[model samples]
Target: MTIRYPNGQKFTPVPLRDKREQPRDHVTFSNRGMTLEEDINATNAYYLNCGMAVIHKKPVPVQIVRVDYPARSAAVIKEAYFRQASTTDYNGVYKGKYIDFEAKETKIASSFPLKNFHDHQINHMKQVESHGGIAFVIIRFSQTDELYFLPFQALYTFWCRMMNGGRKSITKDELTACSIFLPLGLSPRIPYLDAVESMYF
Candidate 1:
């Protein structure tokens, strides 16, 4: 017998025994084909554990509307959506100062597109800067695996130019000159806080 979903698609049913024997490391998808965001998040975890500068990914809250109670053991999400882009990507206190930043990645080698940074992201960063906090974006060129710590002020500069009919995308050369290059490391992977320390502290 085959179980068909509401969409008229056949649902493959796993044997109960096989389901029980399923691997515990399903979350290890990152280990297999991880992203720059995942690497940076792992690095943040390391920093938190070591009592270093505290930083964390800001969760986008969602209103859960439906869930499937497959069994007493599991509650599966059926539908959900983000409430809004409320704030920056990450925020925390670092050495008596507040820190806030967004992380982004792009494959285009010549330039980082302005579309990557939304107006809300820029507005939130501006608020952080106004309050005397550190605001920046950690951008990664996925093709090269190179990362940079771009300050919010510098971004705002380019943002102004673009708003006034200038180049829409920032060239890689401009990024290299305006931002601090983050050192890649084996232990922490991104080693972003190192760049932060060198800049502020």
Candidate 2:
């Protein structure tokens, strides 16, 4: 299958690794090689099951262009294009407050590159905040196995600095100073709501 962006750029999906290739450790609370999105999905599921919150990943809008009838009962989509660029990863309501956030992970140890974010995403977050909603970003430093919940205001500050021809990245120390550190857990995986409660509530 071939999927293209709204700008006609080919979209290459990341290949999933086999679980058998990963080393099994005794520490269950650790991330255990799960991607940030996977961990968040698991945490959202837990929240939903426990009647804590209502959140879900936003689906990308795609327009199917070509399909092949491989068999009488099977139809294979061959080509598709995104209908539009997505704003953020997830959004919903929590504790009667609107929640919107994007999740990103990097393998860098010293800093997280600002190039990972897009202008539209930042603008969307700003709009969300302007309307009295909570907007934030969840960043994962894969090399250090660290996670941080950075509010949109903090992110906007760094983004504005970059736009003004300053540094092109956010240092780990800067994130530590301005963002809330999220500890890994077993049931929720990434315990971000705890940080949200501490910072916002």
Cα lDDT listed for each candidate: 0.80, 0.85
TM-score for all predictions? 0.77, 0.78
Backbone clash total for model 1 is: 0
Q: Candidate 2, residues 71-186: lDDT per residue as tens digits? A: 66788889999665458878988899899998887767888888778799999999999999999999888878899999999999999999999998999999999999898998
**Candidate 1 weakest ten by summed lDDT:** 25-34
Residue lDDT tens for model 1, 1-201: 589889999977765554335465321121123477688788888888888878888776788999889966689889987675667768898888899988877767778877667688899899989989999888887778888999889899999899999998889999999999987887688887787788877
Error of 1 at 36 (Å): 0.9
Model 2, global lDDT: 0.85
Candidate 1's TM-score reads: 0.77
Clashing pairs in 2: none
